[model samples]
Target: MHTPTIGDSVDVLDTPSMVVDVSIMDQNIAKMMKRFEDTRKHVRPHLKTVKSPLLAQRLLNAGARGCCVAKVSEAEVMAAAGITDLLITTEIIGTVKIGRLIDLVMKYPTVKVVVDSIYGANELNLAMQQFAPGMKLQVLVEINVGQNRTGIAPGSEAVGLAKHVGGLKHLRLVGVQGYEGHLQHLAKDERVRLCRTAMEKLSATVQQIKDEGLTLDIVTTGGTGTCEICAEFDCVTEVQPGSFVFMDAAYRNAIGTTYGNALSILSTVISRPATDRAVIDAGLKSLSNDSGNAEPKAYSSMRYRPAGDEHGILEWHDLDLRLDIGTRLELIPSHIDTTVNLFDVYYGIRNGIIEAIWPVSARGKVQ
Candidate 1:
């Protein structure tokens, strides 16, 4: 299929293309920034959702402190695009990845990573010693508040890891990261309460580190669901909410935020099998199926169901709204991160016209 130019209308684009409304995205960014403007906390939006360098730079220009990536390759891509002040939210395990991390530290002055184990910290320190001697790699000790993921317990174990990383000459302990991943999808009241509990544990860990004469600069946590709650806490110096840039169905159902859904899969109706069923060109390959099927946006009664890798079935009870062979429909994906990774380019639309075609720069950089 031929690619559409910037001046082309979104209706002329190919089927199953990832589309982003630039105006709505700008509103989302402004809303997120305004949420923390009254507080002391800052926004460091995560790049895992929208992997485009242009979007990352846009977020930085909109008053975001920096960006966070899930892997070293994502950080490398961001660094090469002239984006500094990046944090690799996940730990770099092997020697090869640690070498890449060291290179990033040498190239970008403010590259940081999360360290949850002493072995990982020592290995990273040793690797940095060989590659970039005298250069300090900033580190944040990850505390497992409730996620039970890659973090130590929030009390002495966290403090002990901080001390270990602090003792290393090549690694500088910056702060702690305690992500409430499990509580992000809960209802409003329960989520806020559990988030407060998690923040309290993280704050206690910070105090433990401070009592040992260690300086903790940044206390980062929260996602799109709990950005407001995390901002209210004075201890959380930075918030890492990734999915706000492109709101998904899952996040929309969980949080009460006013952020609009700026992302959608523009699919064309290819077949009308029956009176009540229609099929689109986008399916599992175009939209993410991890969080159930994508939601139909145009018709209220239409229900989206994944048919296969290249087709989606839409069932509707209304007969007045007809879906012809060439009719185009917009679908709000359940998960934006995985859905975005399936496409190479994002058709940026504003006022029904294609404004720009942004490449998903860090799309497959899941190292």
Candidate 2:
């Protein structure tokens, strides 16, 4: 299909740009909303996937309770877009970062953040006390739900951290967020079992906090891989799945999501380096190598390898190659989130002429 036409045509746009199928994106959003229809869980979709406030608005319209961003800067962009309710899933660190977090809360009045350590909670408390003393920051106790990346131990230690953050002057313990990051792509039965096992810790933590006379409002967990499994857990009140909205190569190959390949890097054939090898415009710069390099999914038989910065070498001479000079090809990125930040705006399309240009509003929100 061609790119949907808005005002400008697709041919005039820059190469190696991110092009999204708006219709496909809607379908993806609808599919996720449908999953949460009869369930009690809230779909606080991870905005880190698109990093676009425009897309986040669409997500809200499509039945998301709010958006979950990884950083305070991302929350700022979404708040600027008029999205008042937001959850910062990452651990808010440093005076500078906490200062920004307090600023965001003061600005939006509905922004929340996760804190796993007493040090982080204390820092936030100090920042709020010094600056926005009246601002109330909702804090989610992040438990180690098999990711082991951040978060405290799931049982009593989690309760201790929650109690500490709760007793803080400015920070209020709103809920618990446990991410099953490691279970995102596990084999089906194993993924379910591991996610359940992880939630067991999270559920116990929630109970322990409740036993201490604390209000446990939110018990959020899950990613695209184990969303269904997480939904079944009685403790989990919400899920923060980012990749479901835009299935990347790793997720598509991992979870078998029904969402089509909506996000693609339209690359042009730059050079045929050798008879056994070819090169394209997209590389480590345009796409991402987080999950591994992008593979030629449509052309699975072809061996797609990255040569360097802006070059993707393809060893696909065999199997009747369709690539030629100036031939535009769509590449599925290895990681959707990183690849999306590589562009300024997404060419939102329907039937493909370039329906709209939506900026990546929260791109590079590393702080």
Off by over 4 Å in 2: 1-9, 317-319
Candidate 1 structure quality by residue, lDDT tens digits, 1-367: 6569999888788888999999999999999999888788889999999998899999999999988999899999898998888988998899878877787889896989999999999998898888888788899999998889889998988889999999998889998898998988899899999999988898888888999999999999999888788777777899999999989988888885588999999999999989899989998999898987789977778899899899999998887867788889899999899999999999999999999999999989999
lDDT tens digits, residue span 52-170, model 2: 88888888998999889888888888898898799889998888787777777887877888888998889888888889887777889989977889989888889899889879988
Off by over 4 Å in 1: none
Q: How far in Å is the alpha carbon of 275 misplaced in model 2?
A: 3.7
C-alpha RMSD (angstroms) for model 1: 1.1
TM-scores of all predicted structures: 0.98, 0.95
lDDT of 1 at 20: 93
Candidate 1 colliding pairs: none
Question: What lDDT does each candidate get?
Answer: 0.90, 0.83
